[model samples]
Each structure stands twice: as structure tokens, then as C-alpha cells.
Target: MNAIDQNAIQTLFTEARTHNVWLDRDVSEQTLRELYHLMHFGPTSMNCQPLRVLFLKSQEAKERLKPALLPGNQEKTMQAPVVAVLGYDTEFYEHLPRMFSHNKEAKSLFEGKPDFINATAFRNSSIQGGYFILAARALGLSAGPMSGFNNAAVDEAFFPDGKVKSNFLCNLGYGDASALFPRQDRFAFDEVCDVL
Candidate 1:
């Protein structure tokens, strides 16, 4: 497969920043749908595809989410065009029969296994969250993914059914780049990776 150009790479990674401040802009419903369509194609373990997103776009919806956020995250998240409550369904294995059609027995592996179910759901959903950010960026939006929130509170407020668990919160919108701090440092490849 051909590699994407440098500009595309920059859009997805290099030039992308974790934006805490949003401009006075709105993310349309169509863009939100398109974002999910692009990210859903990202691969998951055994095609589990357990990531379930709840996009909080309205003032009322964001208000329901307010109490769950940490003080530092509250203002920015409230101001964002969309605050995505990224979660994973504990009952994801039930859908394996439909999602992993090639392997009819895939569902059996996770059924009645609480620890296994939780591990797979969390791991795969986290991977999908990464894809969500890239997809948002590719569509010319900025992302601020944060974990400073009360998980149990959020789950009760939004996913009260208990079938899904909140993984993290990401604020999405047209970023106020001027509000960003100077780019932070990262470990070099040699410091973080080893060639075997």
C-alpha cells in the first residue's frame, strides 16, 4: 500500500496538539457521523469492535456530564463543540457472532469470563479512541483527550444500564491554538524503543 503524504501525516500526528480551548464553533451532526465511520474501520482484537461513543453536544447533555468532570477539565469540556464519552460495552462478546462472522466460535471465548471480557473490551476500545482522534484531525478538527473524570459517576449519569463502562473523555472542536502551551517534549526513539 502507498504511504500517505507528509501533510497528511502532520495532520494526524506531528502538527496535532491536545487542545484545551475551543473556538466559538460547532461540529455538525454529519461531521460527527463521518468521524465515527472513519474510525470504526480501525482494527480490533478478534474484530471485537466494542468501542461505543456517546457524543454530548447539547447544553443539557453537557450539563449532565458536568458533575463527573474534574475541576480543571470542566470549563474546556463544557466549551467544546462536542464532548465524546468513549466507552466499552461489557456485553461486547454477545455481538461477536455478528461481527466476527468468519469465526463462529469467537463468542464462546469471552462468554461468562468477566476478567477476559473486561480486558479485551478496555484494550480494544482504547485503541479505537486513538483512531477517533486521528479521524477527527483528518477532518480538520482538534482533540483534547483527558482522563481527569469520575468514571463511576459518568457511568451512572450516562450509561446507567451498566452494560457499558466509560473509558475516557475527549473534547472536540475548532481549537483555539493561541491558548495552547508550548509543545511538550517526547522521548527519542532510542530512549523508548529497542531494535532487537
Candidate 2:
């Protein structure tokens, strides 16, 4: 890439910040569908996609989610255009025979092993969550991803059956740049990376 393109890539990395305030614009459903299409392609261990997203856009749904939030997150979440409940399915590995192995054999790996099931589910679901953030950015939406809520309460309110568990909440919308804090510093490559 040329220097200008390289600079643009850096801007996408450095300028993208977690937004707490948003504009009063609507994000179309088509855009969200497109975002998911892009995000789902991101690789995960065994290609076991475990992220389940509940997009709360209606006032009633937002109200239902309110009681589960941390005091600090309540306002931003409510004000944002969408509050996405990112969750993981407890029974994710049950589908691995179809998703990963392509045969009936992979089911045996997690059939009765609760620990392995939970580990793989949480790990891959978290990867999918990271993909969600990048997808939002690619869609020209700013995102504020937070884990400051009561997961159990969220699950009870949103996932009453208990098959799905809330992992984190992300507020999505067009950000209000004026409300953004000054950009923060980060560690230099030399400080964070080491080559053997």
C-alpha cells in the first residue's frame, strides 16, 4: 500500500475509540445483516461459531435491559441506537459434529465433558465478539463494548431458558465526537513485542 493508504489504515486503528455518546440516527437492519455476514467469516478454533447477539432497539426492550446494567453503563446503553447482548451458547459443542468434524465423531469430545464444552464455548464466543467490533467499524458505526453489568441478571431477563449466557454488552451507533475524551496513549511496538 502507498503511504496515504497506510496512514488511512492507522487512522482506522487509532481513531476508532469506544463511544459513549451517539447521534439520533437510525442504523438500518440491512446494515446490521451485512455486518454480521462480514463478521461471521472471522476464524475461530474448529470454526465453532458460538456468539449469539440480541440487538435491543425498541424502547421496551431497552427498558427490559436497563435493570441489569451497571450504574455507569445505563445511560449510554439506553441512549445508543442499539444495545447488543453478546452471548455464548452453553450447548455450542452439540452442533460441532455438523460445524467442525463434518462427521458424527466430534460430538464425543464434548458429549459429557462440561469443562471442555464451557472452555471452547467461551473462548470461541469471545473471538466472535472481537469480530463484532471490527464489523461495526467496517460498517461506519462506532461501538462501546463493556462488561460492567451483571451477567446473571441479563441472562435471566433476556435468556430465561439458560441455554445462552450473556458475555458482554456493546452499544452501537454514530458517535458524538464532541463527547469523546482525548485519545489515550498506547505502548510502542518495542514495549509490547519481543522477537526471539
Output the number of the lDDT-best candidate: 1
TM-score of each candidate?
Answer: 0.99, 0.93
Q: Write the per-residue lDDT of candidate 1 for residues 1-196, one digit (tens) a residue.
A: 9999999999999999999999999899999999999999999998999999999999999999999999999999989999999999999999988999999999999878999999999999999999999999999999999999999999999999999999999999999999999999999999989998
Q: Write out the backbone clash pairs for model 1.
A: none
RMSD for each of the candidates: 0.6, 2.2
- Which runs in model 2 stand beyond 4 Å of their true positions? 1-11
- After superposition, the stretches of candidate 1 with alpha carbons farther than 4 Å from their true spots are none
lDDT of 1 at 133: 95
The candidate that achieves the highest TM-score relative to the unseen native structure: 1
How many clashes in each structure?
A: 0, 0
Ten-residue segment with the worst summed lDDT in candidate 2?
2-11
